[model samples]
Target: MIFPTPEEYTVLVLSLKVGLLCVVISLPFAVLLGWVLARKNFRGKLILDGLCHLPLVLPPVVVGYLLLLLLGRRGFLGQILNDWFGLQIAFTWRGAVLAAAVVGFPLMLRAVRLAIESVDPRLERAARTLGANPLRAFFSITLRLAAPGVLVGSLLAFARSLGEFGATITFVSNIAGETRTLPLAIFTYINQPDGEAAAARLVLLSIILSLGALIASEAIARKMKT
Candidate 1:
């Protein structure tokens, strides 16, 4: 294995863990936000839309720094979380997850929103006419129709999280077995004089993983269509 060293393995595992955690944390919120943005017209909708897309527009380092400020021990929400629940998001694995989620969330949300918007509102109305409640109609009609988009969004988010570097490194640092992920590992390898081989291995791994995810997403989308 290219990652013959225990440190490399630790970094690999931590990276995967952070990526998975980011996906799980962002999935539900992405769906809800996507549905709302696609279907509902509310006051301040544009503001909410802009906020959701802010991370995409901002630099990753800036986002990480903002996260550090907002979730630091002395920060407002951070202090409440620490005092009430003893949760710390600074320089930790959880912090890495937060960083990844913040960056990946916009992609997921955008995908899901497009999917929801493509769904015909008439279908929802028909379900409601059959005595289904709004929530029930959404699950039965809107969700089913938007499954492909959701899958695509999830895959995109997962891939994005897996490759996250700047925000993760800035927010959590490149601590082995904690915040070190694939991109961070690659960067570490590249920093060394004789680290080319290791970096190449990780780079190839990232490409392969991304390709596999794209293939899998297409397969799932096709199956849903059939």
Candidate 2:
């Protein structure tokens, strides 16, 4: 019956917030990219797919550094965003969300693409022939059939975001009560002489959260088949 200390609780909440936000922000884009990769055969399509999945193959630190270069305060896009909208992402929770989203996006995209590909294209064509526009046919037929995969992908991305470490730390560093998520908190604890107990607790919590997401994803996939 051990309760989480305030610090642990904060870390937990922040981690959940980041993970959920990452999923919500990235899901729509993943769905669009997945649909395109599965259904379209245009020039440079393979290149686009490879770029989308590059994060999966690259080192997390490299990904983070790239993000920093592209979004740092003085960076081209970062400067524009800061000047135009007064928005900042680096060294903040928002940065954490972005990092997690980028890293987990590949998994989300792959799951959705596979799911959509499995659906019969003819169903969408049939809908189109029935006077529905392409967008309507996709939403009503293709996307509906692929919903389970989308759900599963969301869960998988959530799980990945929860465990995100290298990229987050590299991009945002560790700021207590700010950008310090569960992984960062655990890392901090492990480095301290009296932090083992806290680290262990956080580790267990991380396991629980990640395991739950994975289990839920598997359950959804099974349900989709049946």
Candidate 3:
């Protein structure tokens, strides 16, 4: 019977929406990069790997700032978007998705890449020898085997996005019902007078949700293996 207030519900819903959107939008690229990193070795591979993982090491605020520089109104691509389509991603929900995606991308890529790498290369080669084309074998065997790892990565990304506060607030300015997600709402409550009780409730909820996601991810991984 422990439920958040109506306003807390809004924040919860918004966080889920943004997190799902982030995962959906980033799935394709994550797969492509995962495949390439796991199977191919080319010149500048290290550079590509570093770029994919840079967000993990950098501060979330720094990631948000870089996004602002690239997507803001006065930014390079931002100017093009503004002039051609009148589109603005900064300080918006879309920007929050972008922030979450940037921050969580490495985790997704790591999971998928490891899964792809763990598969036996000889199986793919054998399938090709058995008359399946490279593409066909890959789609049928490699991707199918890696599905579970990718699923785990996606859930991790979702959990990370749900808690995305620093980058989202930095890029989107914490507008209530717009950019203020669960974590941001929790922070707001903690800063207000006599707000500890509400903040404690939200903290418990956040922990529960995050732990549930991790457990689900592990279960899925096990199912995929069998």
Best by lDDT: 2
> Which lDDT tens digits does candidate 3 get at residues 61-88?
9999988999999999988998999898
Every candidate's lDDT: 0.89, 0.94, 0.90
Best by TM-score: 2
State TM-scores per candidate.
Answer: 0.95, 0.97, 0.95
Give the alpha carbon lDDT tens digit for every residue of 1-226 in model 2. Answer: 3889898999999999999999999989998999999999999998999999999999999999988999999888889989999999889999999999999999999999998999999999999889999999999999999999999989989999999999999999899988999999999999999999889999999999999888988887788867
TM-score of 1: 0.95
lDDT of 1 by residue, 1-226 (tens): 6444676667667767887888899999999999989988999999999999999889999999888889888878889999999998888899999999999999999999999999999999999999999999999999989999999999888889888988888888888777888899899899999999988887887787778888998999989988
**What local lDDT does model 3 show for residue 87?**
91
Off by over 4 Å in 1: 1-5
Say which prediction, candidate 2 or candidate 3, comes out ahead on TM-score. Answer: 2
User: In model 3, where do residues sit more than 4 Å from their true spots?
Assistant: none
